[model samples]
Target: MDSARPTPGLHEALAYLDSLRAGDLAPQADVPEDDEDASYDTLDALVDQQDAKPTLRPSPDEALTAIAIMRLCHAAESAGPDLLCPRPGLLSLLFVSSHEDRNRVARRHPDLWRRLSLPFPALMIEDPLGRVGAAKDFHARLAGRLLSGNGVLAIVSGMAQLPPELETLVTARATLPPITRRMLALILEYLHPGHDVDLPISENQLGKLAPVALAPVLAAETLDTALTQLRRLEDVARSPNGGPGLDDVYGQPEAVDALRQVVSDLDAWRAGTLPWREVTKSFLLTGPPGTGKTMLAEALARSAGITLVKTSYSDVQKAGHQGDALKALNAAAEQAKTGSPSVFFIDEIDSFYNRNQSSNGYILGMVNGLLTLIDALSATEGVVLVAATNDRARVDPAIVRPGRFDRHIRVGRPIRSGITAMLSAAVADVIPGPDLDRVSEQLVGLSGAEVTALLREARTAARKAGRDLALEDLQAAADRVQPQLGDALMRRIALHEAAHVVAGHAVGLPAATLARISPRGGEVVRPHLNAMTARDIKGMIAAVLAGREAEDIFFGDVTSGAGAGSNSDLAQATSLGIRAECAFAFGPSLSWISPDTPPTLLPTEVRNRVEARLQAGQEEARKIIVQHRGAVERIAAALLEHRELDGAALAGLLDGVEVQADGAVQHVGGHDA
Candidate 1:
């Protein structure tokens, strides 16, 4: 082995080399063995995150040997005190930032006590449960030690979890420096002379195994085989506890397809067949909650076979002050970079609202820090950063430009098939009694989160009633999540959705993008028509009110659904009309009025002009609806049968209809899909 890279502990390595030349490097300090707390039962009893059976941890003796090997390798470097080792004036109030089992402090070996000059029986408390138990016996034990003038080391996952009663007694807080590759390489060389120690593992991977376990991993017949074993160990330690991969996710095929392509690209890049810049590395998952935005990040990481460091801006701020928060934020960035071929996900990015509200230093620091990290990670080759927000409009513009998040993927509520799959999975263990396809149609308006919650409600009832979950329990829960609308309303929604598609196409829309309806409600993704021309404005206005016009023409009256919310058909039509008149100067009046201005405050003349445009659009929509009655009926029938008609399917169903946006007829089936 080339001895050029001596690592940080050169003194220790040289002494060991001299001992090889002379004799043995006798173990320093006759440190007594203290393996009482290292017992298997104690480690088992500490905490079980999963309700299921816990995985087997290293044996007490195995852990001690690993620790001893690590100390010997980095003898001089690790001689200083850490959180778990306290002597007199040092090692007070050390905060461990990670909740991973590998990052948590293990039972201290005998040499650790001698090195730190600590008591023979050291006492340390790490509250993985945080402050919830602060008022319990924990506070009593900590306070007693402080009052007695005895040394104590208290560790917490976060500073906020530290009760105010003992805040004054705190000296400092920090996270332990993890084991690094340099140390491991030297350990390998020391274990087997002339052995190649230039391994590919990173510091983050080595941090998982306790010091004592390295002998077994490095002692494999060959270094290649040893590496293979270490990879399996790292995978187990870093797994998101068996999270679902891209294939396991049921819906959002567009997002899934995009992620799968990136996964392929990642494989190609690693194989030297694709350029790193061509890879789509950054993403923004924007949509309603319970739509599995975070789950998508998890799936992407699992599908790509990489690590995922999930965090949020709030998570960083929880570290304490602005300085510490920035440190924590930087640490997350470093972890992502070091753990290359990694996915770094930050949730609730909308909270970084535009920097105009930078009233305090903390908010500014966080936003600036995040932007810096995003910029740095975007330039990185194998790292992918995925950010999620329930409210996309609330996010700042600068943070979401083309260079930052290359794709803005929308994760809407699952379609009928996705809902059916979810329902089937929830009750897979129970007796299968219900036709979930029909039930999924009725529950189409519910979000994935709502479906999970309702199922949980059903499980509770089944457990209370002392019987397997039955069709009645599921139906009862489904009703609570989304009440079943009768057949009459269901047909009406189908017609409402179908009319938008038919009218939009008749008015020369690029195409009907999406048409979906449930028994309770429905939605249609309006054709994306900008105000590039007055004709475009007129087309959008007509399509917006087509649903209302269809209802009025068929039923001789209109339901309040059209005018229900700010995003309703009537509201959208009014908005387009206002923009046409005031913003676009396409209407009779050239007067400009802010859309945010309430209708009551608008000038009488401007309001009249806007009202006139709306009336004309509604009349045009009525004409188109009447002309496309056959097209509307055919599509509506399909929606009732399938609960959804989107993309090429909806387009193919409208192939026979011929209309033009210029008020002229055309036979082309061209679309912007």
Candidate 2:
């Protein structure tokens, strides 16, 4: 073969040889040809002889033959049966050696002399372009050969972008061999300009890839799936063609309205009617647990006809390498992008924000990356990002600020109407006469999730007994599932809650629901009466402190529900009280100074102040509970008998009680008279 004008086929063979050089078993320098050797001279003469054969107007079969020959020779040279190329027909024996060995042999002997060492002469072609042209022509012929049942051909391409020629080749008139068309659609969503693509993988795929990928990707995939499931549920929530509005949710008009606003914005954006900048694109659904924060997010995705991507914080954190995790996340986003107009949901976003001080700074970087991704997606078309968190207080405030997350909607527990709706819907099928009114009354302070669970329990009982569900079943279920606050606790809680009610009512704070206790954690539906002014909060603290002081005077020691270790309740009351005195100016001692103007309290100081106020409140709570011992017993007895009572029931029991001027009751440890 002419070195300067090696055939295109030869070049391909050489390139293949060069690739092997980088690996083991690379060929040594070409062995020098012996001019005196008659076999070598004869082979050289034959090679030069073929070069003059009018180039044989190369046919497609000839081209394929050349490629096949090159492949065989290359493989043989790399490793061997030590066989020389006797002729084109003998190339079949070359398969006995590995392809690498064949390539090595061809590299060592690039001329016809190597062939003369065999039994026969093999034709040689000199032109380079002719060789490429021949290769292309050979491929085309191979397409025909494949159609003629000589072999099989497989074409892989993006979804809906299959090559026309290949398609035609497969569908040709000739009897084609079994050919498989594999569609490998890869959708890359550009969440940010420089950010990697976010490929949304299904839950099943997620399970497969997460083990190999980084933590962030796993987190993103998990969140995406959860959100997607929620979205589907939301779609099922509505009547056909926007028929009737959803009636399952009740009482929280504010929450409902906020959700509606988000949905409206999402719809407008989807319809291409809203300005990109003005789109209510992102939201931070924050509130007490069991609220429909997660549900609402799903509902929004469903209504908008989008796939939801749910991610977990723990999964993201567990990703060993930051880059790996990021890549996984990007892949998921990209996957979601394939199905445009998708929702990317990240649950427990606080995990990323509240990285431990010991975390080797990876979390902070991840958070920044997430922020960038979210911001980018917000600006991009056809994608929505929704992050849900219960502990908004712990979330990095920067994330919830203007650009990252513009909408901060508090997803609080269901109100009376909401409870009624939730109960009615939950028990609609099982309860013969579903008294939502009664159920709602009994379910005071219960969350959406709790109500759902209650219904599920009732249904389970009915199924176990082999009977249809009845109100009795629900009531029985309710009996077994005690509220977070029991009778004993409620009596104490009643006095405690009563103090807040009376104090707030007395101080002209908004007249709202009286204190009612439940067994479930986070039962206080609306913890705050209103946005507390500095003065109002101060007065409330004084009342709490005074109640504690009164409790100490009347009962001697603090009660379980009223004193220390009541983390949730105490935290609430103390935090409020402290803020009132120190931050809100509700206390006389700290009213002169603007708490806002001062630097925020150190954690230690805040804890100290909270503890101090809690102690004071404990003393007052003891006195108040003791002074109203009769009323307390009445409420407690009622609670024990009924298992639960609404604010109205407790108030009715206290109707005959006389109040002292100091917001105290007259009776002590006696039955109501």
Candidate 3:
């Protein structure tokens, strides 16, 4: 056999077995004790009990392996006295318990067991465990039985460790034709009471869906059972405070619009005005942590007057195996479908797959199963599949494709006005005065959830001091609960943002606003320039670099605050600097270069010129700060006090301070020379 071809099936099965036996799961999960009573009735009763309680069962892989082994045994029986691969008799049952379980099974079905082993070979493998010599002898006998096509074997063990010869047998069996759909259906019929119920498994879907051995636990006499468990249909009517609606979701207009669009699509589909194919059901929500994605999802469902089916990674993992997880997913889909116009949500969808990397068998199975469930859900009208992730780039690309998760919506960080609104809504008892606006301004880049949490913490702080919610309480809590970049780091960040404001004023950059700087980071918002002259680009680059230059001038050394690489102001500055030099031919030579031209493609002299341009921009910013050192100090002082200042406020402060080259101070009438 070629060494290169991947045997993913074999590896997956092996991984599944290993997972069942790993860590705390081994003793507590799949293993049965050796001293258990030898009664098939007890074992059968236990199986029935487990079937009814899905939470207390082994993974679906065990049942899948058992079925595969049984199919292989049947194949050997049909081969009729000439099987190349080693095979057990017509009734070789791998019980995955102890020798006692095998004996009990034989006792339970005495007639069939006796007939199958009428002419029993000298030593058929009975127990999964025996002496090394006994195991060797059993394999030899098993080979002879396969040659003669007459014998019976039973393998029962709690240990997932397969004997070496048995492992080989399983590998060989993988080459055989898979079990037929008729055979699978028969197995399902024998296992459960309902004959008309739909199973999630099929030949086309076998790779995706696992046959859930514990599915009976979720079975409902009516579809409402599944709907009730997974989809909370009654939540719409049970809302408190004048009932929950879309208004509960704050700072996510785009997400709200998208959800409203989902409701519209559902309405259109139900009215037969929209084609089934045109129905937009699935959506992906992307944002940073604490952006109110979950609240948005719940509010969407609540506002639509429908149920919300919510599931998570931990919930699926608790299902124990592929089959059980698939069953859980199927159950959710079924419930969502049954509860028409419902929202089916998968929180932290990025957790389901390894991005651009090979995932283990369980994750692969989960990804495939979820994809299948999402596809199957299309037939069910008014069921919108919503998945949220903090990092969309970390999710599997296949999941977010057009037909799977058709729409992608973002829940962004809350702005000042949004934060103010959130604060106002959060505070009911105590009144916020002028400092409310100041606090809101300071919370520039916080998420909606974070804003709420900040207020909650503030209230708690105020209550501890036996006082009403005060501005000082809010300020202290904001500082305490905010993500800390350290006090020294905050000083550095303040200087950095202050430099941008001063540079923007000095260099005539348009509409530049210095937003708040928390311990986490800060932002400088500027109006989008429809077009940029070479001077404007250079000025912007200078403003971007002003932070680093300020640190160098004041602190004598710059931290990574300005240039922590990707997505940083320095990174943006460098990118724009390169574009100005190469792409736009804005360099001294005035020669048009390809926009895609890389820095490495530039002539050595041109590269030097690009570096010179960036340095000059940096020097220009330093000169402005030097000329307006008094203004710089004033702006930085005000920023430290308020945590933020708009472009207009900054311009006002700078306009009031004037510095001559001779260091004489005078008041100026207008902002920026």
Candidate 4:
């Protein structure tokens, strides 16, 4: 046998064209037929009968097509035996990137192309000019090979620009994903049969090279050295160039610590020292907006010496059509999985719904697709998945369930210590003994993004004035971002927040994480009540309404702080009451309303029960406030003087407010006395 490879069949196709010109080509109806060459009416018939695996000795174009099949089908070859590749004619489209890539897969239907192991085919659109032409007879010849009976694979590079008549043949369409590091390794290994070849370079580095880059690897004297140099250059390019890492992240000690452990595990894994399953590669971050979920992911990626690819459900859905959006989502998932030592940061992940018959089919498809992608991603060795959502309740349970996301980390607003550290870092030039303790207290409840925004404005102010950023400038900037409330209003805000702390504690709720007064309103960020029983639900409602009750008791009135917005105290209390009556069967009827039903749409009986529940909660809050009046006053005064309270100090303050289950004013053991 000659060692030379066979023509990619395009040449044979041309020869057949030449045969046609010389009047030697037989008509299709008159051609000889056999089981191997007989036309199958359906692709299923071909798939069911043919079990031919791809040829062991595949040309570069065939290898490229294999990678294309994997991408288009979203199938990873690393997934073992049972993972079947699609049959030949089922691969309707084959997308490739550039002219060189186009040349590799175009005009050539190799034996391997005839048996594609992919469910979906890729579609890459380009103008194939002279290589393919608009000649009247040439059209007939090209279509003959493409639409042939015995399965011809159409590798689409210039399929889009094909004459309308030819383009119509493509019933479905798709775009090609980039050549991943794993794909590159496969191509090299396929080329050098029996050799263990692994590229030490990242997908970013691999993507910079076309399929043609393999020529050098196949020709190189030392395979390892070439790969080492390529990786070394990229490592240098990716060096710590003053970018933020986990060390730079301030506040949220638990989140930082958890991420640091993950980074350590990833490092050990990369060093080939850690067991595969020992790494917890995925975690869900739940917190209010701007708590730095994305920032933490970025820092974690930097610490791990990997790239961070940030995307969201909202971003993927921007592709318009459900099919296109799903394609975009698949592409994003493949991008991260292929690029190992990477963090796939998906924000607003809750936007993708859990499977519900009531929801549109599009959402169900997206949710199903996301779950599959996440499963593949979580199982992949080097990928660290960081998914964030503000409302954890809205997230599909399956997506956030243990294995899919290893754990949940609540990235709350920074406390006093975290705030101090953030302020100190922001003005590094300031003397260590400066008043950051006070500065931190003043900005305690603000989100990290809000703080960063104020700091940026301060720096900009200094820059515009041609001066260094002073402590005064920082304070001035904070004032500008949120103008300080009047003394009376400040006191009221402090009282409002302190009441929430005291009421929650009195009702035996968990310790509040933070309590602060801001210009917009006051906040007492408590651990979720996780209220289970009817009484627990009612107690939580009391705590929700305590701010209003405190205002009513102390100032003989209430502010809009507890009522104005949809997220206000009144809204929450009402919601809890509605849930108790309408959904949870905690009230009158055993029947329930549909999920996500608005309160206004509720029946008068249910609405009345909800109102009655609210009234009872108000009475409960009033009793707590009246009993702890002195402690409430003192804590409020302290909050006004200090601007915020948390940790040991806040715990001490709340601990002194003694609780008597029967509504009696009890004495403090040692503190309040």
Which scores greater on lDDT, model 2 or model 3?
3
Candidate 4 Cα misplacement greater than 4 A, ranges: 1-242, 354-358, 430-433, 529-531, 656-673
- Tens digit of lDDT per residue, candidate 3, span 37-101? 22233443233323323332234334344334344345344444323222444324232222222
Can you write out model 2's per-residue Cα lDDT over 128-198, one digit (the tens) per residue? 11121332343354345344443222111111112355444332111101000000001101111233333
Point out the worst 10-residue segment of candidate 2 by lDDT. 176-185
Q: TM-score for each prediction? A: 0.63, 0.49, 0.45, 0.65
**Candidate 3 stretches greater than 4 Å from native:** 1-244, 264-280, 461-472, 482-516, 523-556, 560-673
- Judging by lDDT against the true structure, name the best candidate: 1
Predicted structure 4: lDDT: 0.64
lDDT of 4 by residue, 1-673 (tens): 1213332222333333333335442322221235222222223223221223333343344345455544533322232222223233322344442445444343222322343422322222233322212233444444555544322334433222345776555443333445665555554554554767666765544543455545444444454654665565456435533468888888888789999999778656654467659988888898888999889998887777666777888998998877778667766765664345578999889888656423688888889878866876765556788999988767777888789988778887766577777778878666253566766666777888888888899889889889888877888887777776688988888888888888878876666767777676777765563335687677778888999998888899987778898788999899889888876899868996854688889888888988999999899999999988887888898888777776566888766686547332222111100
For 1-673, candidate 1 gives per-residue lDDT tens digits of 3455545434433343434345332332221246321212354334332322222332223233333334433432433343344444333554333333223233333334433344543454443222233324556666666666665666433322345767665544443334555555655554555777776554444554444445556556656776677677767545635778888777577788889988888767654467778998888887777888888899888777677888887898789987677667766765665456678899999887656534566677778767866886776666788999986655777898779988877778777778888888777666452567667877886777777788899889888999888877888887777887787888888888888888777777666556788755788753243224777667778888888898887888989999998878889888877777776788666666655577778788888977887888899999988988988889989998888877788889888777764742233322121
Model 2 stretches with alpha carbons more than 4 Å out = 1-252, 335-338, 355-360, 429-434, 483-492, 501-516, 519-558, 563-566, 572-673
The deviation in Å at residue 357 for candidate 1 is 12
Cα deviation of 318, candidate 4, in Å: 2.5
Off by over 4 Å in 1: 1-238, 263-275, 302-335, 338-341, 351-372, 391-398, 429-434, 526-532, 579-606, 661-673
Model 1: lDDT to the true structure: 0.66
Evaluation by TM-score, superior candidate among 1 and 3: 1
- Candidate 1 vs candidate 2: the lDDT winner is 1
